[model samples]
Target chain A: MQAAADLGAAAPSRRTEILDGLKITLPFMVGAAPFGVIFGALATSQPLHLSPFETMALSLFVFSGSAQFVAIALMAVATPAWVIWLVTFILNLRHTLYAATLVGYVRHLSLGWRFILSAGLTDETFAAMEDRYRRLGVHRNSHWAYLASIIGMHVNWNCWTMIGIAVGMQMKGLDGLGLEFAAIATFIGMVVQKLRTAGAQTAAAVAGILAALLAALPYKAGLTIATLVAIAVAVIFERHLERRGQA
Target chain B: MSVGIVILGMALINLVLRCPLFLVANHIRIPGIIEKALAHCPVAVLTAIIVPFALHLDQAPDGSQWLNPDLFATIAAVAASLLTRNLMATIAIGLGVAVSLRYLAVF
Candidate 1:
């Protein structure tokens, strides 16, 4: 993973890291392709009846699948505009955590670069970029690689979404494909891979159980509550370890 | 039309939520204790998302939907994920199991 050394200055190895980023992101791009298409299809389908331009515009600007999906579902039921906005906000709280976790890695970056990276941070991009950072065991300035991954997905999402819109206009349905389950399984795989520590492992279990219990909470806020509870428990355990000089 | 405006609102609020942390990342310094928690953020957030939805309790005709296709497939996915450690493979396995079960008319 660490082919280039001497990060001497920001973006010096930009070309190489961008290529590395693209290569690392290839596998995820394949997995996400169908998801983008499905989203586009849903957007243009009868229930939502969104114009292709609206679908593309949302894809271009919003760039979040879950939020868009939730928004579409809400809008299909004629949910209030405020509720749609609120739901999208709650669904996106996880990005705040992604931002916090990336602080140590991107603190040295310029504001302009940070803006670009932040806009691009999603579940898949964060996973790919974070995997690379952990491997390098260094903190900052992989934005070139990070940038590559985000930009690649951005382009891919837009393209497939447009294609999906066209397909939706022609075809009737896609629900039977069980595509959403694939997304679920992907997250499960990511969670398993990152559960390296006992504390983290137990924290994940706590979060999962609590989230399942509170899944009926209004506006999907249970996710935020569950995430916060897990973080609190994990931090408490980490403090114990730190006190014992084992951290 | 009005829908366009609502979506614009979405884009605006979204960018506002997304931009600040990265923009201020250089200025703000997080303390050590919080950093430890942040390290586990991915696992927590991801698990929060997956578990509740994967085990969704929507009712069914023949008793609990716990016996439903999604949950049954998630069980298979979890087992496959633990063994494969590969995201793509896990997705394929889970989707395959769920689709197959659905085709067989399993709840």
Candidate 2:
């Protein structure tokens, strides 16, 4: 991929921001490692029986964990390819919401930069990028930080996917490894790092409970619904606070 | 069925939903209220995403229901993160406890 277009004099310091972004994102990489392994192992199992190559191809291309898992599960059941496509599409439909929210930061870039960044835009990268944008706002070096978030997550994901597939082709069960729980730690770490206010904390807690309650909703629709409702709750609550000068 | 062919189709659809929004982003105007609301989006999204996975409905080997190692590990992780304020340390303690719980089958 192409580097994000340099913002002239701001380019030099961006190199450091890029490093900082990668350093901060290290925990996420560690957290996602187990899930990646599980996905690889699942791809090769009964019903799916996909060769390691096919599994890798899915990870290499789709790069969406939930989407790939849904696809493989659907394929295993001989669900029509179109249904798998549709379901995965709906599951990933949340990406559009993330893109709309994130585009505010990158709207001034060239189409090439926008497109490349878009390809790297997964749920993980979206969190990391949006955090940087919020923390740093519209600085010149901010684009480089964004680029670092994308490349760091992209490489980390693909690398783990390949390793999982490689080990899966050789071994049997990876779940016994118990590494998948790292994703929880990673998410927890990230969430704690950003809980700078009571409103943010409230939104997170509400979203968590709502997600568990609504998880039975089909097609992962619960996540999107819970997020929207939680955002509304937090925003409304904050506005109320502001009225009394507490905000 | 060609797995490769199906994957390519999914890839195409994924790209369509992801890319065009950025292209169209230049045309839209975000109100101050909407932008402030959007500020809440990342934390909300990440929280919702993590909770389901942490308390996954899948059964444990010991036939326990609704209680699992992930829940404890997550609580431990949050506490460690708050106290230590260090990412690597939080992950290490969290994953260590989770794996240990699963191995010991204390649940």
Q: DockQ (Cα-based) per candidate? A: 0.45, 0.41
Q: Write down the TM-score of model 1's second chain.
A: 0.66
The digit string of per-residue lDDT tens for model 2 on B1-107 reads: 67898899888878987898887665455566776676676678768766776676323212235577788888889899999998668878998988899889897
Q: Pick the candidate with the highest TM-score.
A: 1
Pairs that collide, model 2: none
How high is the DockQ of candidate 2?
0.41
**Model 1 Cα lDDT, one tens digit per residue, A1-247:** 1222344444446688789889999887887787788778767775667889999999999988767765665566455576567656655766776787676677676788888888888788989988888886443346788999999988988999999999878745655545456556656777788788877897798888887776666655666688778879888887787779863
Instruction: List, residue by residue over B3-107, the lDDT tens digit for candidate 1.
Output: 787788888777876778888774456577755775677678778766755665322212245556788788888888889887667777888997898888866
- Residue A96's lDDT in candidate 1: 71
Q: Pick the candidate with the highest DockQ.
A: 1
Number of backbone clashes in candidate 2: 0
What C-alpha lDDT do the candidate models reach, one value each? 0.74, 0.73
DockQ of candidate 1, scored on C-alphas against the true complex (2 decimals): 0.45
Question: Model 2 misses residue B104 by how many Å?
Answer: 1.6
